[model samples]
Target: MGDPTPTNPQDETSTQPGASPAGWWGKLRDRANQLRSARRLSRWFNVDDDKVAEILAEVRQQLPTTEALLVGKPQAGKSSIVRGLTGVSADIVGQGFRPHTQHTQRYAYPSEDLPLLIFTDTVGLGDLAQATDAIITELVDDLSSSSSKGRILILTVKINDFATDSLRQIAVRLRQQFPTVPCLLAVTCSHEVYPPSQAN
Candidate 1:
């Protein structure tokens, strides 16, 4: 982005009078030039650690990111939704997730440094022993603490799976807590409703 301004073709320094005369002297001159270039490069990048961190923080603040929280039972296509949103391969999406809490994982699209969207996956949303109240509390705390404004909740449920008594409770809790946050109902596994011949 920062291209050097062009110098005049007639500029004196632009023209090296001649190639170095061949000898040990030429080799020594080349070595010295290499060292000078290296020093210049090093000096250019010799920024203070604190200053670098400050710049990175500013960049983070400037980049607008949407945060999506995916809450669903097992095999509900939460991972597939992430893959669809990011337009990346499933394996890459699978590997990108980093643990956010005891029961949640986070993934930032493109990169953590400059993400356009960040997704938080609730790991144990519908487990029999899992406490949904704790999950709801954690989500509320996270949403309140986050600097991001664009927050959403995605509820993934398999189309054929009607056993949602537990899932419904969680959805109600989240809606009551974060009324402003938009929610999406992602119904998946339509193949489960079709016969074997039509499933393909």
Candidate 2:
């Protein structure tokens, strides 16, 4: 006897990996329709939807402001880390970063108009060309002022350029100046570093 014909050929294709119940083009069309419906609904409701607007306003009002200070040397991926955490574009972060002091800059999430979180970035430390002491002093002052407002210090160090003495000094100084604020040490470019056993 000849093999039985499949009752649902479409179902067979849909069962494959990366295949969707709706075909590729079909999914795009569905998404377009959904967007159109959302636009229509938005036009109907406008900002006059008191319930939604009130809820959003209340949520924003209740959100507490927090600060994160990113301390690291050049090319330590500090901005990259900030982008990952806040889901903000690189260009936005680049443009939004405003000088807070000679050696520090600040970027407010959601912009300064409506900020729920603040990220502070310091000038690269341990570089021969820059005045490390002055930069450290600026950083200390910055942290001391903001420590009362729930601040977290993130220390990013490149795996390839791990300068123990400089990092140790920074940590010790921060501990003495801002004991209440918590510090996090992050090792960037870990993938590029060879494992101990793999090293010759």
What TM-score, computed on C-alpha atoms, does each candidate reach? 0.75, 0.62
| Tens digit of per-residue lDDT, candidate 2, span 55-160 | 8767666668788888888678898898898999999888989988877889999867557888988875777776767777877877666333568889888888
Q: Model 2 lDDT vs. the true structure?
A: 0.80
Candidate 1 lDDT score relative to the true structure: 0.85
Point out where model 2 deviates above 4 Å.
1-63, 146-148, 194-200
Q: What is the lDDT of every predicted structure here?
A: 0.85, 0.80
Off by over 4 Å in 1: 1-49
Each candidate's root-mean-square deviation in Å?
13.0, 16.6
Q: Could you tell me the TM-score of candidate 1?
A: 0.75
What are the per-model numbers of colliding residue pairs? 0, 0
Candidate 1, poorest ten consecutive residues by summed lDDT:
12-21
